[model samples]
Target: MQPDQEVPPRVRPGPLRWIAYAMGAGLPERHRTWVLYDTTTRTWVWRHVVRTFVQLAVPIALVLLLVPGAFWIRAMAALGGLILGMAFSLAYMTEAVENRVKKAGYAPGSAQAVRDLAGREREALDSERRRAAAAKRAVRYRDRRNR
Candidate 1:
């Protein structure tokens, strides 16, 4: 609270603000904007889709240029490229999201922490339900004894 203490400077928002937001970055009021997909997973999936397309297209283009192949050959190469790109993207998605989260100033495994918390909450709710059922049965037995 001392006037002599220097305040930390605010970060200037960048082009990847939406991705950063998905990765748990706090947005400044000035930089907050409308987004079509609200959740981080949705935005990340969309990004992955785009990246997969780009990856597939680039390799296909290179193959067509360098291979001097018949139409069927080029088409097969394109198919292979698509398959490979999809497989790579599937493997890469988790790493990509984690990197984005890190860039957004979150600790690595923050997403996992959230999942673990949710699991604990579910277990607690289940335990409470079981306790409530036991209590109800106990009350029913006591009432029957008094009948």
Candidate 2:
């Protein structure tokens, strides 16, 4: 392929890669392609949620197993673990999202960058509209003067 024609990087999809990404590892160049970034971010977040749930549940389950307890006790333990895990996850959701963004080869402040880009696009569109309107007015004035 020609140098000007850039080829997209190849991303390796697997459990190990997923685990690494969940632990906040940086994304590889192949994974940094814009087309794949969104999907990768979503998958990373989903995996992180599952990992968090499993991480929180295992110890609670083991501890509850060791303790001689009623059915209600075990149930409550599981419920509490779930709630605690969810709370912690919610508390760190922003960080998780930002991590995913960074892993996908974007800056943490890329949301603001996106907003700035959109603002520039809007300004350009508005300028084009104004120019079109002015051109129409100029044409109309010229037509009236000729008649």
Candidate 3:
């Protein structure tokens, strides 16, 4: 991305809307940019984890309350289910985010494209800083060796 490329405005959904979104509902058009940013940002993975937990919350509670078992047994079963759900959810997180972007009316692979661009920009900056630091170290090493 160019240094001056205009980022889309980030309009987050309200609490109700966010709950709906976490349950697989598409957000309104006004939040499309936020949707993309949310899926591709540095904290995107953690964001997904939170959403996954939210998605599972009700079911886990229900299992604990309604299942015929001791309290401890119910909790252990819920924990196992939660762990399995998280593992499966993590495996398809990227695809899930992309589906969300598409649901918000973007083309396929849009989230991946944004993530790739951000990664490239980060790498470029890291490379520049590394080169400058390496040059300074080289000069210091040469002076010390001569002395």
Candidate 4:
């Protein structure tokens, strides 16, 4: 790609923005590319898991701090909340991610669409490579037989 046409780095939201994002807020339109990248990258699942943890963090912390109980009781309460929260978050992982992508000004399912397109492109390239390799093998075998 030409230097002038190079893509800029996706803008990562700051901590506050990230917290808002974990709470289901859509990022600003300028962050559209970042939102797509965040949802469609190879590590997207990990990103989702981390976001889920972030979503649970505040409530869990509050439970540990404010709810009157023994230390073990508070810890147990926080643990239960974390487990239940993660379960729900992961259950709707794809939908939640798609929602974020849509909020970034893209159409619904845009993240999955982008991921699907990339997978197809990769499959095409792999098929081309396999065909080339088979042709090379056939030519090598024919040349050896003739010799």
User: What Cα-based lDDT does every candidate model obtain?
Assistant: 0.61, 0.67, 0.95, 0.90
Candidates 1 and 2 compared: the better one by TM-score is 2
lDDT of 2 at 66: 74
Q: Tens digits of per-residue lDDT for model 4 on 37-146?
A: 99999789999999899888899999989999798999998999999998998899999999988888889988998889988998999999999999999999999999
Where does candidate 3 stray beyond 4 Å?
1-8
Model 2, residue 60: C-alpha shift (Å): 4.0
Return the top candidate by TM-score: 3
Q: Write the per-residue lDDT of candidate 1 for residues 28-104, one digit (tens) a residue.
A: 64432222112143254676566557546657788877888698898888888788878887787767655545554
**Model 4 stretches with alpha carbons more than 4 Å out:** 1-9, 124-147
lDDT, model 2, position 25: 66
Model 3 pairs in collision: none
Model number with the top lDDT: 3
Tens digit of lDDT per residue, candidate 3, span 1-147?
478998678899999999999999998888998998899999999999999999999999999999997999999999999999999999999999999999998899999998999999999999999999999999999999999
Cα deviation at 119, candidate 1, in Å, is 10
TM-score, cand. 1 vs. native: 0.46
Using TM-score as the measure, name the better of candidate 3 and candidate 4: 3
